[model samples]
Target chain A: MRIFTAVVAIAAGILILGGYFFPAFEGMQALLLNWAVILAGAAALVGIFNLVSVHTDKIRRQEKGSVYSALLLISLVATFLFAMILRPNHATMKIVLSGIIIPVEASLMGLLTISLLYAAVRLLRRRADLTSIIFLVTAALLILGSATLPFGNMPVLGTFVGPWITQVLALGGARGILIGVALGTLTTGLRVLFGADRPYGGN
Target chain B: MIELTIILVSAALLFGITLWKRKSPANLREIPALTRLHRTLGLSIEDGTRLHISLGTGSLLDARGGSALAGLAMLRHIAERTSVSDKPSVASAGDPTLGLLTQDTLQAGYQAAGVEELYVPTSGRVTGLSPFGYAAGAMNISQNENVSANIIIGHFGPEAALLTEASDRDNVTMIGASDELSGQSVLFASTQDSLIGEELFATGAYLGAGASHVASLTVQDILRWLVILALLGGAAVKLVGMI
Candidate 1:
């Protein structure tokens, strides 16, 4: 069964990838992608069902944190029902989006700021390596450079060092990583195509 | 035409190296993070602690799915190695298709371990669709589940910091990797062992998934050198033209 799956997958991948160079295979590529999208959509529905079922079972068994499970299900069903009846554009729906969802996400972002700061402060203590020192120093310089004091902007660190570090050093490192990641992505896809590594459960 | 040529060359190189290196052991360089993972894998089986694997929200329908697939590959390797533990490993994914695939991968891993009946569908979860929602859901698992180590590899944004805090607070070992540069930066600072850049994609190879995984790394190195030469060649040619 795994072999059959791998064969089909390899063929599909080859055809789809070949479509870019050979115009004749474009239709098949598009068709396969469409099929994939549809399958993904169906899989999403199944995923939702699985999530609900998992939580539902949790509640049924009176597991630890059963209240949270029940709350999740209730909110999930209620929000879904409300959106269905009142329409997504309705005031209540808008409240759910703007009031609950947006604020919650924003709060998390706020938490991220604090957590990032905390991580940076504790970084030296944790690793204390040369890389850690460089990372912390660069981060500190960047933060300091981005801010303007109550009196006036600094001359060196603010204007010169900041732009040089960001535009040259940071940009160069980021581009290097991007290129490596591109190569990695390419090989990964190729590995799948040649049936070397199958994340699709064939191996 | 150039892209297609590159693809064909990569495919050829991958196939060639894989076949050539089939009998001989792959000489992969030591990555500290991966070494820790290897030790941790053994410890998990010995001490009966579950590993929480969070595959970030990368939809399979798009280009971002590459990291997600890599995560799945590592998940398969981890699941198989740890299936016999008193507590089996659990996986979480943010995207639905990826989540479903993780479930299949987990089951397949257990099957390979000859413990098909021990497979639990709920062990693989679709945590949430949104980024933070997914992080939040998986965060609960890291804290609540009998997880000693958290392996987060895939696509993540700043929300990854949230998981970092969870791991840190719980004193759980976390080895995080992501295709996102920002995610990498966060994980690098927070987690002691973080795979950076292409290293995230190297998880399967590092974990000994198969020869192809190692072959892909070799091909990546060849391509990287080729790309460097191309850039330098282009620059030299342009300089000569100006001269």
Candidate 2:
């Protein structure tokens, strides 16, 4: 099983690398990435199956938190029926998802950010680490500068310290992180392929 | 042609450096944060404390990244450790594919540890519908599992607090990280050094004894340095333009 998975992984890697060099093979490369998406699509069943099995078992056994499990089962089935079978138009799905999921998420987002901000302020006042201070100051300036538009009249002033600067900094940081991530991804992938790190049936 | 050559050459250089490190006889360095995680894993099981872990919603098939892989590696570790201790390790998922991969992985972990008899599907659930649903499900697990140790490593969004809050209430030792936007909750709560963005990619390679993962870390380090240089150069050019 490990060997088979490794061979498949190697094939996928080669197709990707080959496509980078040979434009003629770009179509195949595109197909490989597409295969990744398809794999993700197919994997969805794994989670659903898990939910069903767990919740159904809980319901059968009448576990303490079985109510939550039962609710999960009902929600999953309802979602599937509403989204897949009904093929509810975008507006209807949007309303349903937003009405239920969005508000809860939004509340969490707001609460988490606000609480963290308060803690950060206290942290800045207390420990005052150089890095933390820098991060805090930059974030504060960004927020303040953007919210107030302090340099409204002077376009140059605004341009120098405004969204553009933030954009450049954000992009640079993002790019650096991306490079690091890409390398990290390649390395781990190779390990799984080589059977050096077998989380699957390979070892 | 040039770009491809550049990428291949850089990749090769990185691969070489990583291989060199593997050949070295240095003992694996223990990260302080990871040590805490290890301690938490052991303690949870020893005391009948449940451990709650999430592999995020995205599966290996759905979203391919180091974060997803790291989440999986951590899950395997949690499962094996928890199983040996005869403690329940509950896992939750937002992405069904990942949920399945998680179950299989946990089952494998238990099998590897010779504790397959302890494997329970109810312990690892796929309950969340969306990102929020996933968080809610995780929160539920934190409460239900009476989680003693909460270790979350994956691609998570702003909804991180839900689970963290539950852990906090339970007074569980929590360690987590997200590859995407680092949640304020995780930042505030977790003692484990959460890897932001690309740092997450190095996790599996760093933890696993493999050539590819090590090489990837080395290359990633080199690339990071290059990026730093570029940023400095870019800043200098911008300063000059301003002048």
Interface RMSD of each: 1.2, 3.6
In candidate 2, what are the lDDT values of residues B160-241, reduced to their tens digit?
7666656666777767666664552344333334445555554454445355555666666676687679778999999899
CAPRI category for model 2: acceptable
Residue pairs with backbone overlap in model 1:
none
In candidate 1, stretches whose alpha carbon ends up further than 4 angstroms from where it belongs are B241-243
Tell me the tens digit of each residue's lDDT in model 2 across A62-108. Answer: 86788877776787788878888658676778888789777877887
* Per-candidate clashes, comma-separated: 0, 6
Top candidate by DockQ: 1
- Regions of candidate 2 where Cα sits further than 4 Å from its true position: A30-39, A78-86, A90-95, A110-175, A193-195, A198-200, B10-23, B27-31, B59-64, B182-193, B205-215, B226-243
**Candidate 2's fnat?**
0.53
